[model samples]
Structures are given as structure tokens and as C-alpha cells.
Target chain A: MLVIDNLKASINGKQILKGISLHVKEGEVHAIMGPNGSGKSTLAAILAGREFAAIDGGSVSYFGRNLLDMAPEERSRDGLFLGFQYPIEIPGVSMVNFMKTAINEHRKYRGLEPLSASDFLKLMREKKELVEIDSTLTNRSVNEGFSGGEKKKNEIFQMAMLEPRLAILDETDSGLDIDALRIVANGVNKLKRKDSSVIVITHYQRLLDFIVPDVVHVLYDGRIVKTAGKELALELEEKGYDWIKKEAEKTEESWRVNPQ
Target chain B: MNGNICQGGLFTLQESTVSENMENDSDKILDEVTSGDYKYGFYTDIEADQIAKGLNEDVVRMISQRKGEPGWLLEFRLRAYRHWLTMKMPGWANLKIPEIDYQDIIYYSAPRQKVAPGSLDEIDPELKKTFDRLGIPLDEQKHLSGVAVDAVMDSVSVATTFRETLAEMGIIFSSFSEAVKEYPDLVKRYLGSVVPYTDNYFAALNSAVFSDGSFCYIPKGVRCPMELSTYFRINAANTGQFERTLLVADEESYVSYLEGCTAPMRDENQLHAAVVEIVSERGAEVKYATVQNWYPGDKNGRGGIYNFVTKRGICKGDNSKISWTQVETGSAITWKYPSCILKGDNSVGEFYSVAVTNNHQQADTGTKMIHIGRNTRSTIVSKGISAGVSQNSYRGLVKVLKKASGARNFSQCDSLLLGDKCGAHTFPYIEVDNQTAVIEHEATTSKIGEDQIFYCNQRGISTEDAIGLIVNGYAREVINKLPMEFAVEAQKLLQISLEGSVG
Candidate 1:
């Protein structure tokens, strides 16, 4: 469903993702793990079509379309979703209104009529139940004055409402408590289907226990160094990222010496 | 007639067409320049009786004589004119007042009406069509929205509805000229009680040559049956509009009044100076709302209205309340402050305002609250939005006297800037002589961040709608105070004003 070939990206003349390659098929879950500043979130942002970073080389293809050529909103209409690391707080915009606008916009993109008010409200109630979001939270402003746990749960709620084909959850479990993590992971697990895929980006191996991944890749120094089964997450959790860093350094030295 | 073209159906059709085009290709939506022309820029063709260009004692006398004012009213006009001559135009406001050639502006201009219309059927068809084109449903049958309307064109009242029903409840609803003739005692007692003739430069000017405006009075213990509304339109060219409005709420009565204004587009800037006064007696509550949409000129700032208005109210008796709500999204230059004097013990005052300036428009508006009696309270919420190359400023004052023990005041002023070229400013003056008073003021300035836009765009919402949503949310605190129908119209006006303001 998605393909990235030798994708080289940079921000402010500094390379963030260099020659990164990845492939994910339908119904599969992939996890991209790395230490701080290792370009894990950068890869997620690039896939989301964020314009902050420039693509210096290579290409990305999604559903037989050039993903890089599309705008952010067009990418969204093409069934791509990016769960933000830090959810924005838009004061005065109620969560219900925001969701209605998003749902109607997606429907418009698909050449479908907007849902009626009653139908929309019923859908919201259904999704709220799936995500365990309180009714009062949906009536308030979008993410304003929300606790850390509520923010994460609201993101999951939005994901359920959008029902995107490919969702990239970037650090969704970073600031969540045990209960919130369970709820978020459970929501994502239930939303998964045979035709949809998810890319879970995180630093800790704790989240992998809840939503098991089919493939785990360790990213270091703007490149994917290794790809293996989900067991690699346990091994990396037992031993920190020191071994990976040393290995990457040796490869760098050898490349400098060999000029390749 | 063109009124059919300006109906609600046409607006809905246009909106659907835009969204339909947007669905096919969302990428080009951002690049598309979706600016809309002014909808109320058309002029009405009518024979007018206009005074020669000048501002002098003779012109003022001619206006008074034409209206057949009593001798005392003429003397009041002369006193204001004499006082205005001694006062040079005050330039303290944060406005760039162009060299206004007062000698070149016609003081009085009224559409020629041989006799006053006794009913809606007798009103001039041309004038009725003009109001219809402006989206003001003046016909009682077509609009049973429970809003009594007083439509004013140029310097005279053309039609007023629901007068008989209100009169049955001891409420006096009529034109200022008619009030001067029929209810002279009531008009004389409360005309300048709140905003005196020597209040300011614009107030003095309005008092001197002011022609016509709505006059409303709610008698003791009477709650107004419906919202009292007045629509002001400037149709004649080279004419300066000066309207005077007086509203009085007797003891234990309640009333809500709404005012809206628009002008025909012209190349040369027209002047509009107006004054509004309100008096609330013991246990009475008065709410005044204004949606000012005067012509704001073209994108390049070629022509618009210079709106200079003075509006103030007084809580004259114990436990009385007064509130002012305004949504201003028009005028090339706007300099107005609706104020309240809390002279009654335990009285309350509130001012909710949303001021939006786009393209080349400039607005400097706020409110003033004076706490003079014991245990008085006031709340002020002012939101200023600046888009395109315009500048919007909020200048307010809150004063508490020494004898006003236990007084309270809370003020929140926020500014949102859409583009990099526009500017927003807040200047709040606070004076507290009573140590027991609790006064709080909060101000914030925010720019529409790129991240916010991207976030919305990632949710399948286009940039234009995202900006509109963000702006409406920002001004929701103030817009929610307007009446239901006017709230929707104000939201649309906000959207239209900010269109094409972003890249």
C-alpha cells in the first residue's frame, strides 16, 4: 500500500532522512524505533506531506500516486492520516463542530453528500463510545484545557472518525498513563482492518506489547540500520541503543575510508 | 428587480458552486483568489432635496426648519453648532483623518417625499427596493421575525413598523423628528442626558446637523415585546450622514435595540457622524446591539465611509443595567466608543465587541465604563481581528471613583493577526481610586501560525475554511452576544471581510 525508495530529506540545509527505504503492505503493522534525534518523527512528518522539510532526493508512492506531489489536504483525502505528537489546542472551536467539518470535507472529497445533523451526531456517539471519550469533552473546545490523557484519547477518537487507509501514529504513547495507553492501543487495534495499515513510531518498546508489530526497524543517523521481526523490540529494550550506535559509527568510518 | 438577485437563495447557490469546484481538486483551492465584491454597494435612484455644500448656522437652521422642530430644539442646535466651531477636530484617536473638507460636504440630504407614508403600501417603491436589495426585510408580512424595524435613508425616516403595537404597551417607537413633534416632553428630557452636546468633536457635530434616527421608549414595568431595530442607509452622493438616536427605559422596564448601517460605494470618501444615547432607570435593563457594515472601499482603498460615532448609556437608578454589543466589519475609518456610566448603586455594565478590519480598512473602537456608585460592576470583552494590510486597535478606559467601594471590573482584550502585513494594537486605560475595588485586565496577541493551517489541512479542511473557522472561533465570545439572526449575518460578514486576505 505504501513504498519509499531511497528517500533523502533535509530541513534548513541539514539532512534528516538520508537514503531511507521502506515498504509496507496492507493489513500489516510496522514499527519505526529510534533514540532521540534519530529521524523517527521526521519520517512520519514526511509521509504526512508536511512542507517544513525539503525532499532532496528519491520518491514516495502511495496507492499508485506520487505522494510527494500532493498537498497536505489532498494527501488527507487520499486516505492518509498523521496523529500529531502534540495535539494543537484550538480555542472556541468545539470538538463536535471540528469533527463535523472534517467528516463533511472527507465526504465531499469522495463526491458524497454531507451527513445530516442527526446522523452526524449518532456517528459521533458511536465513535466516542469506541474511544471512551467523555461526552462533555466533545462539547468543549477542541483539545483546549484537556489533560494529557484526554488529548491522546481525543486523537484516537479523531482517527476512528476519519477511518483513514494508512495511519501513522507518531509518539502517541509518549505522555499517556497506563490506562490511557491501554485505551489508545485498544482503539487502534479495533480500528485495524484487512485493507488498512498502521505505522507506529515510538522510542519505548512498551507500546509494542499492546499493538504487536509485524516488522520492527531501528533508525539511527538518518538511515534505517536494521529490520527484523517484532522480537527485535524486546532485545533492544533489554539492551539500550549503544550497540546500534557503535555499529553505525563503524559503518560510517568504513564508508569514509572506502569512499563509497 | 435586483432584489430578487440578492435573495438568500442566490447566496446558498454561490456557496454550493464554490464547494463543488473545490471537491474536484483541493490543491488549487489555496491558489484560487476567492475575493468577493461588496454586495451592498448599489445606489438607489431617487430625487433628493440636498442643502448646498457647507456647514454653517444657516444650514443647521435649514435642517431644523425643514423638520419643523420646536423653538427649543432650534436653540439646542445653535448651541451645539457654536460649541463645535470653538472646538478644533480632536486628533487624539489612533486614526489617520484625511483633510476633511467640511465646506465641501452637503450638510443635509433627504430623499424627496411629498408626505409621510401612513403605511407600508404608501412607502416609495424605489426606497423599498433599495432596502430589499440590502437584505433588510422591511415588509412586515415577508418578515414576521418579531423585529420592529425603522428604516432610515439619507437624513430622514422612510418607514417604521410595529409602532401601534408598541404604543399599546405604553412604549413610544417613532422617528426622532416625530418624537420631537408628538412626544416633545419625553424627547426633551432624555435626548442628551447620556451623551451631551459638548461630549466630543463628533458628538458635537452630530448634535448640530443631525437629521433623523429612531427614538424608542419603554414605559415603567413594561418589557418590550420584540427587538427594536433601525437600519441606516446612505444613498445620496457627497452627503454627510448625521443621525441622532435616543432610547429610554423607564423604571422596571426592559428593552433590546439593534442598529445596522450600510452605504453605496463611491470613489470619494463620505463622512458619517452619529450619536446614540440610552438611559436605564431603577431595576431596568437595556441592551443595545449594532452591526456596522458601511462601505469599506475597494481592495486598493479608493473610497469608503469615515464613520465617527459617539454612543453612551447611563444607569441612572439603583440596580439598573446597560449592555453594549457591536460587530464592526466595515468603514474605511471607524472611530467610535460605546460607553456606560454606572451611577446607580449596584448597577452593572457590559461591553462585548468584535472589530474586524480587512484590506485597507482601519478601525479604532472600544468602550468605557465608569463605576461611580457603591458595589457597581462592569465586564468588557473586546476582540480585534486584522487581515490584509489593515490596522485594528482597541482603546478602552475603566475608571472607579473613590466612593465606589467594592466595585469590580474585568477586561479581556485579544487580537488575532491573519497575514504578516496587518497590525493589531491594544491600549487599555485603567484608573482606580478605591482601594477596595478589584480590577483585572488581560490582553493577548496571536498570529495565525503555519502549523495550525497545516494541522487543519491534514484533516481534509481547506486553507480558506480553516482560516474562517479559526477566526470565527476567535470572535465567538463576542458574536454569541448578538441576536440569533444577526449572529449568522455577522459571521458571514467576517468571512467576506477576510477573503483574499491570506495567500
Candidate 2:
């Protein structure tokens, strides 16, 4: 469903994602694990078309179309969803109104009629139940004064509302207690389908335990140096990232020698 | 006295341009706003009894003589004219007032009606059409829901509907001229009670040449059955509109009055100096609302209305209440501060305002709350929105006198800036002489967050509609205070005024 080849990206002249390559097929859940400053979030941001980072080299293809050429909103309309690590707080903009505009816009892009008021409200209720979002929270300004748990859950609620084909959860487990983490992971698990895919980017392997990934990739120094199955997450968690660091260093030395 | 002084310099921080492209974007947005047609710019083809372009004691007298006022009224105008000559134009506001050629402006320009219309049908069809185009229904049968309209064209009250119906309830609603002729006692008693002739530079000028406005009086113990509204239109060229509106709510009475103004597009800036005085007696309540949409000059700020208006209400009896709600979205240079004087014990005063300026429009508006009686309370909620190189300031004063024991006041002034070139300022002055008084003031300044815009854009709403929604939400506190029909109109006006103000 998504493919990235040798994605070289930088922000403000500092190369963040050096030479990264990844691919995900339909219905497969991929977990990208990395330590701090390993460019895990940068990959998610680049895929979502955030303009702050410059793509120096490489290509990201989504459903056989070049995703980098599209605007951020167009990417969203094209079924690319990024769950922000830190959700934006939009004061005076109710979540209900925000979701309505987003849903209608996406429908418009797909040549579908907008939802009626009753149907929209019904959809909101159904989605709220999926994520356990409070009805009052949906009426309030989007994430304004929301608790950390509420914000993460709201993101999932929005993901349910949009029903994107591919969803990238960036550090969704951060700032969430164990209960919230379980609820968020459960919500994502329910939204999974045979035609949809999920990319879970996290520094910790805790989130993967709830929404178990089929493939696990360790990103180090802007490159994915290790790929394995669900057992890799448990092995890395037990051994910590020190082993991964030494392996990444050896790979870097070999790449320098080979000049590939 | 020290607390009454607001300490701040206007335009202290120079805005830094982020990029040439951003500057160009702002200019393009402003161009879009200015390109929109001024829907109320059409003029009536009626001949006017226009006085020569000049202002002096003699000109003031001619206006009084034309109105055929009593000697006392003429003397009042002459006194105000003399006082105006001695005073210099006030430069305290954060505005650039291009030296107004007072002598070059025609002080009086009344449309020459062949005969005074006795009813709506007798009114000139062309004049009625002008109001119709402005969306002001003058025909009683087609009036806005329950709003009784007093349509003022040029410098005269053209048609006043539902007058007889209101008169039957002892609610005297008529033109200022008619009031002066028939109900002279009420007109003379409260003409300048709240805002006196010598209140300020503009008030003095308005007093000297004030041609026509609405006069409403709700009798004792009576509640006005319908909304009383006055629509002022400036249609003539080179004419300075000076309208004076007076409203009085007798003991135990209640009334809600609305004033709306608009002027046709003009190259040379036309002056609109108006004075509105309101009085609320014992146990009486008065709510005054204004939606001022004067012609704001084009992108380059070439032409528009120089709106200098003085509006105030006095709570003269115990338990009286007065509220001023204004939605100001136009005018090139607006200097207005509708205030309230809480003079009676336990009286209440409120000022809710939303001032929007775009495309070189400069507005320095707020309100004054003077607490003179014990337990008197006031609340001020002001929202200022500036876009496109415009400047919007909220300068307010809340004074608690020595004898105003237990007086309380709460004020919140927020500014929302749309672009880098625009500016927002707040200067709140608070004074308390009594130790028992409690006052709280909060102010905040915020720009339209880029993240907020992106969030909206990602959802499918266009940048323009997103800004409209955000701005309406910001001003909802003040706009919600408007009457039901006016609230919808105010929201639409805010959207139109801020169109293309954001990228």
C-alpha cells in the first residue's frame, strides 16, 4: 500500500532521514522502532507532506502515485493519516465542526455527497464509542485544555471518522497512562481491515504489545538496519537499544567502505 | 487621576516582514477585499437642499433656522458652535486624521422632499428603493420581523414605520424633527442629558450641525413591544452627516434600540459625526445596539467615512440597567467609545463590542463605565480584529468614584490579528477611590495560528471559510449579545469584512 525508497530528507540544512527505505503491503501492520533522533517521526511527517522539512532525495509512492507531489490536505484526502505526537490545540474550533469539515471534504474529493446533519451526528456517536471519547469533549474546542489521554484518544476518534486506508501513529503511546494506551490500541485494532494498513512509530515497544505488528523494523541513524517479526520487539525490549547501536555502527562502516 | 491615565505608546513595535511573498500575499488579500462591490453604494437621484460648503456661526444658524427650531434650540447650537471653534481636534487616539477641512465641508445637506410624507406610501419611491436596496424594509408590512425602522436619508428622517402603533402604547417613537415639533418637552429635556453638547470635539461639532436622527421614548411602566431601529444613510456628495439620536426609558420602562449606518462610496472622505444619548430611569432598562457599516475606503484608503461618534447612557434611578452592544466593521477612521454612567444605587452597565478593521481602516474604540452609585456594577467585553495593514485598538476606562462603595467591574479585551502588517493594541484605564470596590481586567493578543489554519485546511474547509469561522467564534461573545435578527446580520458582515484577509 505504501513504499519509500532511499528517502533522503533534511530540516533547516540538517539531514535527518539519510537513506531510508521501507515498504508495506495491503492489510499488513508495520512497526518502526527507533531511539531518540532516529528519524522515525520525520518519516511519518514526510509521508504526510509537512512542508517544514525538505526532501533532498528519494521518492514516496502511495497506491502507485507520487505522494510527495501532493499538498498536506491533498495527502489527507488521498487517505494518508498522521496521528500527531503532539496534537494541535485549536481554540474556539469545536471538534464536531472540525471533523464535519474534514469528512465532507474527503467525501467531496471522492465525488460523494456530504452527510446529512442526523447522519453526521450518528457517525460521530459511533466513532466516539469506538474511541471512548466523551460527548462533551467533542463539543469543546479541538484539543483545547484537553488532557493528554483525551488528546490521544481524540486523534484515534478522528482516525475512525476519516477511515483512512493507511494510518501512521507517531508516538501515540507517549503521555498516555496504561489504561489510555490500551483503549487507544484497542481502537486502532478495531479499525484495522484487510484493505487497510497501519504504521506504528514509537520509541518504546509497549504500544506494539496491544496492536501487535506483523513486521518490526529498527530505524537507527536515519536508516532501518534491522527487520524481523513480532518477536523482535520483545527481544529488543529485553536487551535494550545498545546492541542495535553497535550493529548500526558496523553497518555504517561497511557502507562507507563499499560506497553504496 | 494616576490610575485614569493609560501608559503606552502607539505603534511601538514595528512589524517585521517574514518574506516578500508573504507581503505580496497580504496585499493580494487586501486587493480581494477592496475589489468586492460596496453593495450599498447606489445613490438616490433626488435634488437636495444643500447648503454651501462652509461651517461658521452663520451656517449653524442657517441649519437651525431651516429646522425651524425654538430659540432655545438655536441658542444651543450657537453655543456649541462657539465652543467647537475654541477647541482643537483631539489627537489622543491611535489614528491618523488627515487634517479635515472643516470649512470646506457642507454642514447641512437635506434631501428636498416636496412635502413631508405623512405615511410610508407618500414617501418618494426612489428614496424608498434606495432603502430597499440597502435591505432596510421601510414598509411596515414588510418590516424586519418586529423591528420598527426610522429610515434617515441624507440629513432627514424619510420614513418612520409603526409610529402610530407605538404611539397607541404611549411609546413615542418619531423622527427627531417631529419629536421636537410635537413632543418638544421630552426632546428638550433629554437631548444632551447623557452625552452633553460639550462632551468632546466631535460631540460639539455634532451638536452644532446635527440635522436629523431618531427620537424614542418608552413611557413609565411600559415595555416597548417591538425593536426600535434607526437606519442612517449618507447619499449626497461632500455632505458631512451629523445625526443625533436620543432615547429615554421612563421609570419602570424597558426598550431595546438599534442604530445602523451606511454611506455610498466616495472618493473624498466624508465625515460622520454622530451623538446618541440614552437615559434609563428608576427600575428602567435600556439596551442600545449598533451595527455600523460605514463605507471603508478602498485598498489604498482613498475614500470612506471618518466616523467620530459619541454614544452614552445614564442610569439615573435605582436598579436601572443600561447595555451598549456595537458591531463596528467599517469606516476608514473610527473614534468611538459608547459609555455608561451608573448613577443610581445597584444600577448595572454593560458594554459588549466587536470592532473589525481591514485595508487601512483604523479603529480606536472601547467604552467608559463610570460607577457613581453604591453597588453599581459594569462589565466590558471587547473583541478587536485587525487585518491588512489596519490598526485596531481598545482603549477603555472604568472609574469607581469615592462614594461608589461596593462597586464592581469586570473587563476582558481580546485582540485577534490576521496578518503581520495589521496591528492590535489595548489601553485599559481603571480607577478606584473606594476601598470596597472590586475590579478585574484581562487582556490577550493572538494571531491566527498557522497550525489552526492547516488543521482546518486538512479537513477540507478553504482558508477563507476557516478564517471566517475562527473570527466569528472569537467575536461570538459580543455578537451573541445582539438581537436575534441583528446577530445573523452581524455574523455575515464580519465574514464579508474579513473576506480574503487570511491566506
Clashing pairs in 2: none
The recovered share of true contacts, given per candidate in order, is 0.48, 0.31
Query: lDDT per model, in order?
Result: 0.87, 0.86
Model 1 chain B: weakest 10-residue lDDT segment is: B1-10
Every candidate's CA RMSD: 7.3, 5.0
RMSD of 2: 5.0
> What's the TM-score of every candidate structure?
0.94, 0.92
lDDT of candidate 1 over B39-139, digit per residue (tens): 78889999999999999999999999999999999999999999999888888888888999999999888998766777888888888889888877668
Would you list the clashing residue pairs of candidate 1?
none
lDDT of 2 by residue, B1-503 (tens): 01111111110011122223234554454446533445566678888998899998889889988999999999889989899888989999999999999988988888887888777898888888888888997888887778899999878899899988898999999889889999998888888778877888999999999999999999899999999999999999999999989999999999998989898888899999999998999999999999999999877888999999998999999999999999999899999999999999999999999999988899999999999999999999999988878999999999999999999999999888776788999999998999999999988888765445555655556666677777887788888899999999999888888774421
Tens-place lDDT digits, model 1, residues A1-260: 89999999876567878899999999999999988888887788778876656689998999989999997888888789988887777778888888899899999999999999999999999999998888789999888888978988898999999999999998999889898899999999999999999999998999999999999999998999989999999989999899999989999899899986
Assess each model's interface with DockQ, reporting 2 decimals per model: 0.29, 0.36
- TM-score of decoy 2: 0.92
